[model samples]
Target: MTPTHPKASLLTRLARLVRMGSHIAHGFFILAVRYPHLANAERAVITRAWARKMLSIFGVEVRISGDNPGFYPPNTLLVANHVSWLDIIALSSGTVSRFVAKKEISDWPIVGTMAKNGGTLFIDRSNRRDASRINGQLADALSQGGCMSVFPEGTTSDGFGLLPFKASLFESALLAKSRVQPVAIRYLDAHGQQTGTLSYVGDHSFGLILKRLLSMKKLVVELHYGQSLQAGEGELASRFAISNAARREILAGLNLSDDTPDTARQTLACPQAVTQ
Candidate 1:
């Protein structure tokens, strides 16, 4: 028997697809032409609008908790647990920010072009040197007062728990003297239970994931923003320390134990804990 939530009908899904196509075209135009001339405020508005529209088309809702910081402060670095490709879209819906993503994404069909124009930095994982270059670029971006984000896990996992955060990118925040915002993201069903219907793990293709998401009965993305970490002096300011601290805040926000059994290839979780 099916759950209480009703899945999207074929007609509704079709309508959504049509609208998404149009929205993508509009985004391309804005990024290719208008974005170059738009002021930062205007660009943030466009980015938020575009992302919200994309989520709306996929029938996803966003629930935010904690002291909502509203717009991202300049020279801020947002670090979050990566669950799926949708994480990027969900975060973008909140504010205008650049992301450090896998280099392969830069080659994905239409989305690749949009990501490039939208200021996403792509890192080639196979090359160790790529991380240094990305860190340098991230420092430069943060120095210029541009808000940047990265999935410090260096890969995606099921939302049940977080992978150990890689410390490489945290150096950028320290170098730029930017505040680090630790955000815990969770995908839930109508009943508020965590769901893996949105996890983009394993060998899933983009088209396959999109189709699954579009057919979902209900989706709610919870973003728990922890207290922003200050760039303090001494031991606390080291990249390793900052990374661990950020991970701890995210773990608290997720209500997960330090030794939570690994079900990352299996399930999802949404801890009611608040860390604002």
Candidate 2:
């Protein structure tokens, strides 16, 4: 009830901060040490619990709808719109899945090390050849019953809109013949108005974002898990078609307008088109 309790006592704020720091430290230790030796199932259990603790510390609640991946094919791929780094935290809270992140993220301070330990696959979009490499690796993982997710939008967007998805990641599903699940993530305030505080886009530096997040009273994210399907589930799907289907489903779930411009085009990579 941070919103109603605006004058949060110094002790209360300090408590939240200490708890958040402790959770993050504990998570880092697990990722850096113990998790690496655990079986896939054990890693999933520990990571999911750690993520939920982190979410609770941040005072961010995730409300899930549609088909929770927790109950679906374990080897499926999850595709979703990217809003902020927090998206990963929210998703991890729902279920555990390896993430497909940008190569830059793999070098981002503690986050980078943590991502590597959490089994993230880093994509260097500039190198087309790397796509095939990742595809092969992803196929191997999928065949072994691993679930992976990518923000096919190729970039993050404000909560009110969505960018088209880039099609490359779908190659994994094609190679593994796995189901692709489209998800939409949106941040809302206490009164249910769209909140952009969680967006890690534009000129927002990491430090600025951290400050804003810490200052905010509460954050609510809605996770809409849309339909999941394989290339030949209904109509045969080309990679482009699959990518489009994922984006379209996410757009619908967030109730975002299709015509929303690519606001991040100048700064973020504007892929040819949005596709699975």
Candidate 3:
């Protein structure tokens, strides 16, 4: 299901062009802020407007199922699986939440710049000390009524399944007493093949994946927002319970066969431990 070489190159070129345009749009916003009259909500409106424009320029199609924009409360933590970089753009356009991205993304050329400008929280997962520090920062952000989007899977998959949810990241939610909402995203080709090879897993480079996406005639992404789960009595128990519930909801939405590698299947089957 991987894209052909020629198509991949085209998608990359298109991605570069889109990035250039988004930068220009962002610069305009910065300049607009010189006038002291814009309030915080007004400024946010402008940024979101630009984000919508950027997505259109990049040719990413987004579809939503369950819960409109106002359905969930503010300052909630959105948990979802990782598939492509587009997941960030897609989710951001649909919700007013900052991203919790890996540290490597902060250094990723144009993509990194855009993510930082959009107020992404970059975490250095390789260092436990740094991770602990970021956890405090995340708590502060949530306390201030800011919403954050996180991918519990820790890595991207081939768009055919869900990965295990890392329970550690749920710590901030516990600290802030924030509710967790599970979101599921699926990328489909024109012919409706689930795994048309747009995944950026294994040795596949971002450049190659971007190229394939741009050359696509019609790309459709389905986003499903599952019911929100509140932090319960215990941190470990709540993390496990919410993670498993979110996992099942996502799997059901994608219509994916529950059959997979033994480990993945077992992880999905076990209910997350709950606190009293």
Top candidate by lDDT: 1
Supply candidate 1's per-residue lDDT for 231: 62
Deviation of model 1 at 199, angstroms: 0.5
lDDT tens string, model 1, 70-90? 665689988888777788889
Per-residue lDDT tens digits for candidate 3, residues 1-276, read 455322335656566587856666665556344324654355456555555666666555778887554422466878776777667667766765677766776676665675666567877766766656666787788778777777777667776777766776677777888877788888776666565356656666666665566666666778888776776645325666767776776777777545643123222111111111
Most accurate candidate by TM-score:
1
Stretches of candidate 1 off by over 4 Å are 1-5, 263-276
For candidate 2, what's the RMSD?
A: 4.0
TM-score of candidate 3 versus the correct structure, residues matched by position: 0.78
> What clash count goes with each model?
0, 4, 4
Candidate 1 worst ten-residue window by lDDT? 267-276
TM agreement with the true structure for every prediction = 0.90, 0.88, 0.78
Better of 2 and 3 by lDDT: 2
Model 2 misplaced stretches (Cα beyond 4 Å): 1-11, 260-262, 265-276
* Cα misplacement distance, residue 164 of candidate 2 (Å): 1.2
lDDT, candidate 2, 1-276, per-residue tens: 112312334565577779988888888999988987898888888878888888777677888898777832477888888777788878878867888766877777887898889888877866777777887888789878887778887677765677766787687888788888888888887667777765766676556555556655667889989887786456635777888888888888988667866555222432211223
**Once model 3 is optimally superposed onto the true structure by TM-score, how far is the C-alpha of residue 25 displaced, in angstroms?**
5.3
Give the whole-model CA lDDT for all candidates, comma-separated: 0.78, 0.74, 0.64
